[model samples]
Target: MKSVTVKNLIDLFKLEVLIGNEHIGRVITRSRAHRPGLEFVGYFDFFPMERVQVLGKKEINYLHKLTEEERNHHIGNIVKYHPPCFVVAANQEGLKYLMKYCEQEGIPLLRTAEPTTEFINKLDMYLIQALAPEMAIHGVCVNVSGIGILLRGKSGIGKSETAHTLIHRGHRLVADDVVTLKKLGPNTLLGTHNESTREFLALRSIGLVNVVRLYGRKAFQEQSRIVLDIELTHWKDQALNNDLELEPKFSDYLDVRIPYIEIQLQPGRDVASLIEAAANNWYLKQQGYSAAEEFMKRLQNE
Candidate 1:
């Protein structure tokens, strides 16, 4: 997940800074004077400390009625407890005090002319994301004409080798060895490899080589929308999760579901050919034509 700071919040909506410059917290407040999580919309708790704080119109209207002392008490209590970075609201209609409070307390204050609904919508979406879990696996990801394909397997499983072969066959590479996945939204996943891992493919006997230098730039993609996942594992004593046969299932990490496929590896199994066929098969299933399903239906009819 992207750590949302006050600056990030301001940048997100193109809002002007109004007050509170020194405040920082994980929760983005929709109202300055109200307690955290009191906002009806876009209120989230249990977020990282670097998360952005936001304030909306309803809370601002509520703050307008309080006396100076009461407002001060409320803001003071919030600063003492939560210490939010930004107090975002819709417009500056009745929120002149927000600037004053930020100046006095060194907390950042931001205002967006955009309506409360739109502001909340954007912030909520930007804030809600699942980061890729830290893992050490040798793999390669490719965005072949906008299709996100991840190749996974054990060491010496020909993962990187197959990726190189696929690239030779006119496919675009996204990442190699380690893939960082981020759930941008429901059913939308973005995959990126670490800077250190970019374009570095490991060959069984040759060691690590710079693919970008050799493949001329088309061998690396910083990011791509993940559409499919393929895992290569040695033929071993393990069971495949049957749920993958129903709805494309993935291991849930940080509240995100990634579509995954597990392929067992053995000698003489052409990994590159399998990958290509997997992509084509995935595409067919995505378009509502499943050969397996068709065969099953035919058998039942007969």
Candidate 2:
């Protein structure tokens, strides 16, 4: 797993660094945050002290009600575990004790003006994405008709060319040669381009072309939720499956299944147009309309 640090979180959410800059380099592997509700009363059993510790307004106010000696003692016990960081949400008061203990233990102390629930939600989402399982594959991802489609096949199968044509047709290219897919959730996969070559598209005849330069910013997207996988199977001796196409196919990634299909690539085939239709058709199916199923029902009625 690549390193996701406290400093990255600070920069992402614009959190205030109150103390322990040296400890900002701590790695955060846990996606869930720990609120010190139990630890405030000295309950350490089953306490997930390794995750980001968030002290909300209620927790802060509870501590403020305690004596100085008691407050410092409880915070003292909590910070000794040296969690990744202590985030004070809602910019609530009564942080002097927490600051004191965290500074002594060399833990990063962060402050956010956002309310407790909202800030935690944002932080949790970021953590999930940063820590999600990731894989890189050789393909071109594109956003067509509000659907994220991954075009995958062997080299010279026109995956890039189709993506290029789609871009010309007003679709946006996510990645060209290499696309990184992260499992953001059980059913969600985010397809994004590599940072270095995000804007460059490789064509066998024309060489590398900058998508932004050729098609402007609208023609390139940072990331998208991959909803479909189109495998361009070359029409090499393999007969197309007409009957199987009605039920749809599936491809699995990181234990999650995505709607998959095979488009036989023959000479003089308008593969780009087929892909655009595929995107639109998939959207309609999601809205409870399947053309094949509907047509079959009409035949049965007749």
Candidate 3:
């Protein structure tokens, strides 16, 4: 279900616990929060119980105008729905009645000093990132010329060695051995190093090495947006029937298509330089310039 507990939010936001300390372990499945304004007016038909209920200044002011008996009745009904928790934003007053109701019902009541809008904005961002879909790929990711390039191939095909060479050339290594990919938006895929392998690269003869320590901090990046995927293959696998021109190919990750390319690994080929050139070519293509297309046009003119 990929749920985070109310305790996580409490710790992350440093929220003050007003009541129901024992119930902080309650699960919060939804990333969005709800304001209980309409629910306070005897309208509970469409209320969302899965979301955290927020009591802002506007809702608290309305509650202040209610009679003791009426306020308790409405608050009791709202608590009966059993929302994950209730957050009082801006630390508004007039929350004694609501706090008492939550305490009685064993519902966690949290108080934050931030305004309603700002608090919600931060909470939403945190929840979205915490709940984003993620996957791991067997490859090495590097940032070259501001472009994230992923190198994939069978083990022992020099993916790590290529990344090591690139790092020496001033490019930054994002991940090696395993790259974790998270889908943040519809078309955005972020790549990061797996925690166990962060800042470490494995080479066939050299064994494990710390890339950051060897090349300094500039040789490693915590994460990068994967814009291109390159698959390294044996030289014998190169197909003679394939087109030699720069044709755009795509690889799908979390339903987002990324530009894909394949490079043949052979003796004496400067794979690192080729990778750098690929990154530069990708940058040029993004700027609406294609050297291959321009060359074709020139040939036609000649």
Report residue 184 deviation for candidate 3 (angstroms). Answer: 2.1
The true-versus-predicted C-alpha distance at residue 191 of model 2, in Å, is 0.7
| Residue 147 in candidate 3, Cα distance off native in Å | 2.6
TM-score of each: 0.61, 0.90, 0.83
Task: List model 1 lDDT by residue over 1-302, tens digit each.
Answer: 22445666666568776654444333443322232444323334543333345566556766777788767766655554345565466565666666676677677777777776666666665555322233333467887655788787776677877888887777777777787776565666677777787777777788888777887887677788777778878786556454424456675533556577777777787777777877887788779998768878898999
Q: CA lDDT, every prediction?
A: 0.65, 0.89, 0.90
Best by lDDT: 3
Clashing pairs in 3: none
C-alpha lDDT (0 to 100) for residue 158 of candidate 1: 70
What is the TM-score of candidate 1? 0.61
Location of the lowest summed lDDT over 10 successive residues in candidate 2? 236-245
Global lDDT of model 1:
0.65
lDDT of 2 by residue, 1-302 (tens): 65589999999999999999988999988897889898878789898877999889888888989998998888888888889998999987657767788888899999999999998998888888789899999899999977999999998888998999999999999998899999988999999988987888999899999989988999999999999999998786647555723666899987779999889988898999999999998899889887777878888999
- For 1-302, candidate 3 gives per-residue lDDT tens digits of 67899999999999999999999999988877899988888888898899988888999988899999999988999998889999999988767788888988889999999999999999887887677788999999999978999999999999999998899988999999999998878888889987899999999988999988898999999989999999999987536344447557999998989999889888999999999999998888789997768888999999
- Candidate achieving higher lDDT, 2 or 3: 3
| Candidate 2 wrongly placed segments (more than 4 Å) | 42-46, 244-247
Model 2 pairs whose backbones collide: none
